[model samples]
Target chain A: MAINKIVASVEEAVADVHDGAVILVGGFGNIWNAPSYLLTAISKLPVKNLTVVSNSGGFGIEIWGGVFGVHEHDVEVLHRTKQCTKHIVSAPTNPLVVNTLETRYRAGEVEVEMCAQGTLAERVRAGRAGLGGILTPTGVGIPEIQRDKPVIEIDDRKYLVEKAIKGDFALIRAHKADRWGNLVYKGTSRTFNATMAGAARVTIAEVDEIVELGELDPEAIVTPGIYVNRVVLRQ
Target chain B: MTEKFRIDDQTMALRVAKEFKDGDVVNLGIGVPTLASNFIPGDREVIFHAENGVLGYGNICTAGEGSYDLLNAGGQPVEPRPGMSILDHAESFCVIRGGWLDWTVLGGLQVSEKGDLANWMVPEKKIGTIGGAMDLAFGAKKVIVVMPHNTKNGGYKIVKECTYPITGFRCVDLVVTDIAVIEVTPEGMVLKEVAPTWTPEEVQQLTEPRLIIAPDLHEIELA
Candidate 1:
């Protein structure tokens, strides 16, 4: 694993991604988000039908680029969209995540999976912790959501299966990163970045500014060096 | 000084809304509480906070003025004010935790005699999570509840004890309902004023529990 964290641009960072691979993108409604430059890159490239791992299905599709179609077309929108959906899987209850579903799901083009935000946090935690699958009592019933249908019996108590989320490519936004590839965020930016890095096979970050490796505080650095494959500077 | 202080659900919602004051940071919980923002005097600044992480929420967005990407916690297209700020989810919680909120107007299933609030969760249903209702109930300096006086079948909502899960400790300060305005104190839901055409005895009779009467109740100032 040649962990050369610094790359020239987001395009070079995500150039390896081919069409049809699932990519986990970081950001909430385009704020403190993974570098969109890659999306800009893929927009022109041959890649299509991208499976994006994100809080919502939002991108230029909802605004700016008229690609709000992606918000409708995401096969697995991690949050609820306006597409009018039901909880098929355990989903995040966080309002922001739910709003995404309310908007895109009602459009009837996307499928929304409802998972707990804490569960998403924990699952990503498991990926970082190097575990196969972690179990919990998050989503049990309402009977409509049918993931892990087998009612696994644990001491007469029933539990549902929550599968781990692993992505082929991890995209993240960092406030600062060094040329050697250490990253930092201005505030509570660590919410999804660390877990996203762990869950993805090739993690790519688009940082506001790139610096040297030792330029960052060893303690302040959230995602460690092992998980990050490459870092690219954002415009 | 005998002017009747009666306001139905809508007026109660709009009139008590005067307390928001200009430029005051306010968080409107779901439902009727959400309507209070509409009543807020718009000429001056009254910033609204929706826990889903949008600050400086604006009123009725015109067509084409709304951003598909910009949304309220409820996921509706809302006009971002001139001074709007977007925040991350966890950081939004921090603003609530840091006591940055001025007032939180919440809608409740019930307001107990002790001012306890039961707004966020419904036991056994398992539908929605208690997003920052608990935080706002206790975090905001002032907690105001706006609700209907009676249920559909004419049952009262102001009760002796909450028969539901609670979002915060005994923390509700003022309640503006269709029938009356009540203040939640340690002494229980003391009747602060009577709605027009309704007597204290009539209001008490309609209530499930005997709400306490303040020694000196008066009419709403009607802001």
Candidate 2:
């Protein structure tokens, strides 16, 4: 069967994003990371009220990396750049995300949802499946009030039945994708991208290489074409 | 069981620390439980375990001592006392999982009259999780809860049935709150004492699910 997926440019893929949209951006720190080109599009888009879900805005060579004191320019712009009000950070709490989201939250620009590190990953899984909520007992009643909301009860035992979370779009960076939209994430980049694919309504993948459909092995496909909505190539 | 009184969080922590005889391994859950370490009296040979791969932790460290990767369950930088050993996450989990913890001090959002606990997660919070609270609750030889007697809204944390999620059922052995110190017995939450500032009736009113106070219960004083 001919692949229904077509390769589009980066901008064309994310152009439809509107203000106050929730977007899941997958990647961790200065290791195998997501494509900056996509993040650039996100930043350039300036979509307000965005809930940016990510592991880390890594420093170093990472699009989110900056060694504690690496810059020589008396003025800083990278970490200093503030996200717009519409950006909401929904993911595990980490230093990088804290710094990024803190700037926004403290500025009263965005909202933060701190999910347990493991639970945060599972949330994408739950979100994509369209489940009511996943029961894991991540938070029963740690705080009386968390961020001005009550952690309500469900069954006899307390569990934070996190509502199934879905996103407006996902900006995924994979190592390669076949023209059919079958894709594979190389090493660490696979971190949250594969899971994000399941949860996002519209997934925009920026692949390093795009090959013919059958050129890739069937077993190698981490994300099936059915889940994928669009594909684009970096080079 | 030994009984004592405390005027505030610091006093409560100190009074609980006095219960340690010697050479006991303990795990302190996040928040209020973390304070117990600071209140421990002079050298009595106590070791602390952290769920995130740390053992024999010291009190919260001051800056300029040395930069350390050691952290409590809350992920905040903590000072590992004089003789501390660092292990991997899984091994540390084993310490808790193996029931090696002699005692554990935990904070509770709500404690039912049945001794059920709800402290790890709250509603609508993306707190990211109930870290190691369950493990410590079930694994420790003695589970001690330290919290306020009543919530700010005047609702009792001690209830007939937990309105929040249950961390462990009939697992808590002792509950030490700002109001009074009580123990869980088959008969129910046996009221050990009433806070010095309040009367038994006041404590009873603050508590839902009527409490079973010990007959000889007298007000407790901190050591």
Candidate 3:
């Protein structure tokens, strides 16, 4: 049997996602890096009460369309359509605009669990690496972040113990991928996409180009095929 | 309705830029701190780090010049310089959390006499974005906050205690406002330099905390 993980379409790639699933959406609030097709497909699904973990709660597709001059969806579709019940994010609201997530959060339609960006990354990394948790000094003094969390003193410095964040699915964007799902990224597009690659049980990659196996440079692969469960080429 | 002679935003940024040393790695927050990049001295080589995963990037690109794929922490496209490296978000925070940054300039909502910082949110909004501010606040070797001395309604921002939620405890090292340059010392907030044509008494009148007058206090120097 050949090791082919490439799927036919974005809809087919996310077909197995169910209601109340934990989804890790990639990108740093930019259309170029976001898994727009997968997000659109997920938004069209009947699934409800999703838990979205990302760096931002998204500023919506229209705002990004204005910024990049492209009509692409972002994680905001989840909140706009009322599919997401909770958002575990670092930046949940944009200062310039009142995004969909903020609107929903204010209306008591959605919940938010905010974390520092670095701590969010490390938590996802810990999930992928099968670690228990991490201790850091990022939120030592803030009561809102330190509430009910255990604190340990290391070398006389207080550190908060942040738990790992694993997801049911990870929707990521990549520059290119092989049939076997070996992925490489371009520029800063690699931000959270590369970080959430293997941080979930099922990692689905939406890539710009899909090549034959062994076509990708052996030394240049940012995410090996074993970590990727499926790959779909962008339309 | 009295007209005051406060320094402008660019001049405040220039004052903050003077704190940078050659070969120093600095992370700049959004707003006024981002403006400091434009004022870095020509003779010195300062590496700029963005939380979104680019290091040693050049200046912010004008419209139609840079690609959308390359953006700073502020979500603005920036020029790609030689020796610049792009990594994933995880690796980018490693540079931040690992304490490799020599200085981090952030815009402040409020700073306490104890050097506590509260810039992430205003309590009335009921929603705040943490972003990378908490990490940058606690991780950087030296933290410098730049903002106006008072709120739009003429309320003090540099106070005896921050009423807004704190970003970091005892994290602020220095503060550069529109009217004065204040240093957060072990004893209290020290008034180090005043803006031209502004007196220390006038600055203290708007400030919430009592300021210790530095012996060598002078007018803010951009050079």
Candidate 4:
């Protein structure tokens, strides 16, 4: 049988997500790179107590209104609707405005595990590559970040051991994808989307355009179809 | 005392920009450090790296210009430059953690005499984001911190030790503030230059740690 990973709708794409699922939402805190449709579908679901791993906690849809002139939802929708209970993130708070994650965290409504940005990326990559963990120099000597984590010395330098983080679902945004789910991204939109492509049990891609198989240049594919489980088109 | 002469943010950034050498791969953290990209010497070639997967980007775009997809570390839209390459977050940080960056200019809340940097969080809030600061602070070949010399209420930011959570240990090489330019050295924090009309003694008054005045201490020069 031929492989067909395309899903019918955004809601159907996320239908099997259970309560307390771990989700990896891709984006660098901007609408351009965010899987807004997928996140919105998840937000409308009754799923609760979710774990979200992303770069930023999100600036909410309202924050992007000034730039895009259209209010588009981001990962913040998950926090705003109270679907996510825990967030593993690098940058959680915006310096200019107090986002939903900050408000929820301050009020003790949610939990946050802060990791360095590079360390977060490596952790996700480790999950995809099936590594046990990564020894990084990022949080070494910082008491807050180091807090009880094992430290290993190599070549006369101290490194911290950070465990891998694998998610049950990865919601990613890409510029284009083929029927086989071969992906290509544009500009900086590739940030965490490409990194989290295969770092989950189910990797769902929300692309701006879908093309026929063999349409995507063989040499230019950023993500192979084998890493992706499903593809959805933007509405 | 009369209002002490202090340079503006742009001038401080210009002074910091003068430190960039030709062919330097530099990363600019958010805020004032982001302004350094606008002031790099015209004759020099400096590649700007953003933590959000863009490298060799040109400058912050004006209103109604540039794509939202192309942004700096500050999330501001930027112009695409020739020879620009976009990578995923993993490879973008590989460039950072692999020690490919020559210099990284970051904003600081407090910098210790030992070059400890604490800029990510405010202790009073009990919640702050680390972002990519830790890796940038530890991974860059040299780290430069740029901020005002003191807090809004006249509190010392350049201190003997950081009270807030630190971003990295012994990583800062230079600090450019509105009132002075100080270099971190084995001996201590060295007061290299002061804002025009401001004395080293005046700068030290706002700093928590005692400064070792440079032998050739002079007024800050932007040109």
Using alpha carbons, what is the TM-score of model 3? 0.97
Fnat for each model = 0.03, 0.05, 0.94, 0.97
Model 3 regions lying over 4 Å from their true place: none
TM-score of chain A of each: 0.73, 0.78, 0.98, 0.98
Clash pairs for candidate 4: none
Alpha-carbon interface RMSD for all candidates, in angstroms: 7.5, 8.6, 0.7, 0.7
Q: How close is candidate 2 to the true structure, as a TM-score?
A: 0.52
Ranking by DockQ: 4, 3, 1, 2
For candidate 4, what is the lDDT? Answer: 0.91
The list of candidate 2 runs beyond 4 A from truth reads A1-235, B1-6, B62-66, B75-77, B124-128
Per-residue lDDT over A99-194 for candidate 1, one digit per residue giving the tens place of the 0 to 100 score: 454345444544545444434444555665677655544344423332555556698755556567777777776778765556676433444554
Q: Give per-residue CA lDDT, model 3, range B67-87, as digits (tens).
A: 878888887888888879888
The runs of at least 3 residues in candidate 4 whose Cα sits more than 4 Å from the true structure, single-residue gaps closed, are none
Against the true structure, whose lDDT is highest?
Answer: 4
**Per-residue lDDT of model 4, residues A1-235, tens digit only:** 8989999899999999999999999988888889999998999999999999999988888777875675779888898999999999999998868999999998999999999999999999999999988999999988878989999999998899999989999999999998788999989999999999999999999999999999999999999999999999988
Q: Model 4: which docking level applies?
A: high
- Which digits, one per residue and each the tens of the lDDT, describe model 2 over residues A99-191? 444444455655545544334555666787877666544445534213343355666655565566678887776777876678787543455
- Using TM-score as the measure, the top candidate is 4
DockQ of each: 0.09, 0.06, 0.88, 0.91
Compute each candidate's TM-score over C-alphas. Answer: 0.55, 0.52, 0.97, 0.98
| lDDT: the better of candidates 1 and 4 | 4
Q: Which 10 successive residues of model 1 chain A have the least lDDT summed? A: A75-84
Any idea how many clashes model 4 has? Answer: 0
lDDT score, candidate 1, position B179: 72
Candidate 1 residue runs with Cα over 4 Å from true position: A1-235, B1-10, B62-65, B124-127, B215-222
